[model samples]
Target: MPSEWDTHTSVTATGDGLFGAELDPGWVVGGGVNGGYLLGILGRAVAESVPAKPHPLSVSAYYLSASTPGPAQVSTRVLREGGSVATVAAELGQEGVTRITALATYGDLRAMHGDVATTAEEPALPPIEECVPGTMAPEEVRRIAPLMERFDIRFDPACVGWAMGAPSGNGLIQGWFRMADGHDVDPVGLLMVCDALPPVTFDLGLPGWAPTLELTVHVRAVPTPGWLKVSHRTRNVAGGMFEEDCEVWDSAGRLVAQSRQLAMQPRR
Candidate 1:
């Protein structure tokens, strides 16, 4: 059985470099489809355009507006199809309105193996049993953000204070992430995982929804079949805007993905 992430993000060719996709309601957050889920939809179309290079090595997406659950069109243009990597530009639109535009470089992760260097350390976390469930949200928030139900996200104890009305004021979130349905997370799934956690601003005592304005992710390696350790932190916040840095480490202790996004502070 295909995973929900795969099933919902699937795209079908409708000719003219445009693929048909559906925005599943289950992936909605803050009255709009989760940006990561939307990114997956667009990335899938770009992948289909260049099947030889299936993995998204790097992707930068700009959100122009929110998208609702319904039929969506993903149109892609091959910017540069190279031997090792393919660069493509894409747009995800609904009802003739473009909601998100993206550019991506795709490559085969299996074919890349080289030197590894690490200066930054992955956030150390206790066993999943000791962490708090990310799905433990207030009724109102859970009602508007069903995306939480799609994954088994266990937050680091030190990071759960935000949810309990006692934010840590540290602007950091650490957690263990994996599909609740037992499906293996692939390179593309990293898009969703990168943005799966609550915005780090929540722990900084910022309330309400923080919508992403732009997101960029780099896929470093394919994940092993197990849980992924995710950490997101924000070091600056000003002018009602902030930047978030995210890292995902696979079960094999390999760095698989990294992301950074700029978003608005919650309207609250």
Candidate 2:
């Protein structure tokens, strides 16, 4: 049996470079569908269009409007297919309105082998058991954000203060995460998990829907099966917008994915 993530992110090719998909309401957060989940839909479309490229090396997406649970259309166009990679343009449309536009570079992870050097270290986190429940949103939060239940997220207790009306006044949030349904993480899933956490604004005492404007993800390595250590940090917030950077490290201590996103500041 396929995992829920696969079941929901699944897509069917229509014709003329178009694909049809369904947005699962369970993945809805705040007022619309989770951005990461939406990316999964788009990513799947591009992946299938270029079957030789089984993994996404990099993906950049611009969210034009909020997406809701319903039928969605994905239109894809292959831009370039080369010896090592393939580039594809894809978009998600709903209710006749285009909600997202993306460009993705796909390649085979198994075929990737090159020099890699990194000075960045994984975010410090206590054992998962010592962390707080990262899946349960408060009643007020639950009313608007039900997507948390789809994951097994154990947050570092220090950065989770906003859940109790108190924030750490910092821009860092760290946690361990995996699909609650036990779906193993993959390159496509990396696109989703990289943006799975609560907005960075929540750690700064700003509680509201922080809609993403743009998100770019680079998949590093195929993650070894285990809980993923995820961290999100923002050092800049201005002009009613903020930029957050995220890192996802596998249990083996390998950097599996890196992402940066620009989003609106929360307004209640």
Candidate 3:
């Protein structure tokens, strides 16, 4: 059986056909679930809960309340089912408070066209073996590097050159990463995970401590590449508020997803 961290450990079905899972503390931060991991767990939960075929392509989530530590309860409800798509709403809570809510949509097929926005061709995926190990704090690197157990990554010096170093006045990160499990997962889930990295980048900027306040992802497609490149940048920070944005690309150099986050920095 997958451990609590690998996947949801305990879940129950409701009379209304919704499903709920107890959230584990290993996944929570600031008394709320890590926004990125929550999206992953819930995205996978919804995918497992329903009979949809193509897998979740998009998800939009709202953070309503802070999730308390320890086992949290998750409830999923089917909002709509259509000929080619399905939609679900998920609520995660603890202590009688709804902490997080999400709406996920899945589709069977997407229109493919030759014409779309394109960017300067990014460099080829670098050899993971040749790239230097990331320089993030031991704990943070341990936390995120393990995530690569689920995704394949080839660090690009130009993009992710100094990821662990202090964030320059500009919060920017560039790199390549993809599902290490060797399968395309929900695009939204990809965005959710991708968005999580910037907070660490932002924190690195401070001489002390900083925590994330909000993260948002906008997925453009189900990434088809075995590898993806990222260009993440933070545009502003003022009065305890900071913002970062990430632009991700498929191996083919097509824009695949983008993410943005707002955070509060407190002196450590």
Candidate 4:
């Protein structure tokens, strides 16, 4: 329950190449770098280095080894910048060994012809204000509440309630969120938060330990939603690995992003 940042080494910026950060305690089952956020971090690093206004729309990261939260580096290389899309390749390494390789694409929206569809009618979930705030585990509450405070989260107790033994059904969850500080919540920032949540969903029914191994996200737009709704459901779990898929929607129920993850299950 220590600080997420405190548990890890400081992030360093290498002026010559890529930025690097390290995680402390190396790697644990459910405590590794959230995969979704890793993709976002790599994607942001790539898009920010470019002169174009387009942001990364898709990110794919392969886990080469256990990403320890101690000291790691992210190196980015621009692969191609065409008339429409820019492709980037990134590698994260620790102690001279590659840990993750990521490829990302950035593009600007210029009005394309495509069929726009909507998600089916979903029942209105509880409001964040009405949902109970963290109070049970003081250490965990101390750690995550500040982080949540940074983002405007309209949480559904029905989703997180199970962690407190409230009988949260299966691996189904819904919630709304946006950056609370009013910073430009780009796709990468959005992805970071997305990858951080599925572990909770996957651990809903388990009596003990869980950790995410890898996460991949496909983003469609910059996502300027006043409220971003997330619907997460577990697809399958086998051979000590689990997968959870989620769809992200705007306040008006417009689909904006999609994500999937694979994690290792470790029992206490």
Query: TM-score of each candidate?
Result: 0.98, 0.97, 0.69, 0.75
**Candidate 1, residues 1-268: lDDT per residue as tens digits?**
8888889999999997889998999998887889999998898899899999999999999999889999999999999997899999999999999999999999999999889897878789999999888677788888888888898989999988988899999999999999888898899999888988888988988877798999999999999999999999999899989999999999988889999999999876
Model 4 over residues 231-263: C-alpha lDDT tens digits? 777767678877777777666566667878786
Q: List runs of model 2 lying over 4 Å from the truth.
A: none
Count: clashes, candidate 4:
12
The Cα local distance difference test for each model comes to 0.91, 0.92, 0.58, 0.61
Deviating ranges (above 4 Å) for candidate 1: none
lDDT (0-100) at residue 215 of candidate 1? 99
Give per-residue CA lDDT, model 3, range 65-174, as digits (tens).
Answer: 66544655667777888766778888766666876687777654354335676664554546766654443336755463343344445555544434455345345555
Ten-residue stretch with the least lDDT total in model 1: 133-142
Q: How does candidate 1 fare on TM-score?
A: 0.98
Best by the lDDT measure: 2
Taking all chains together, the TM-score of candidate 4 against the true structure is 0.75
Model 3 misplacement above 4 A: 1-17, 22-33, 48-50, 53-57, 64-70, 80-87, 109-114, 119-130, 135-166, 178-188, 198-204, 207-214, 266-268
**For each predicted model, how many residue pairs clash, with residues at least 3 apart or on different chains?**
0, 0, 10, 12
Show model 4 residue runs off by greater than 4 Å. Answer: 1-17, 20-31, 65-72, 110-113, 120-123, 134-152, 180-184, 198-203, 207-209
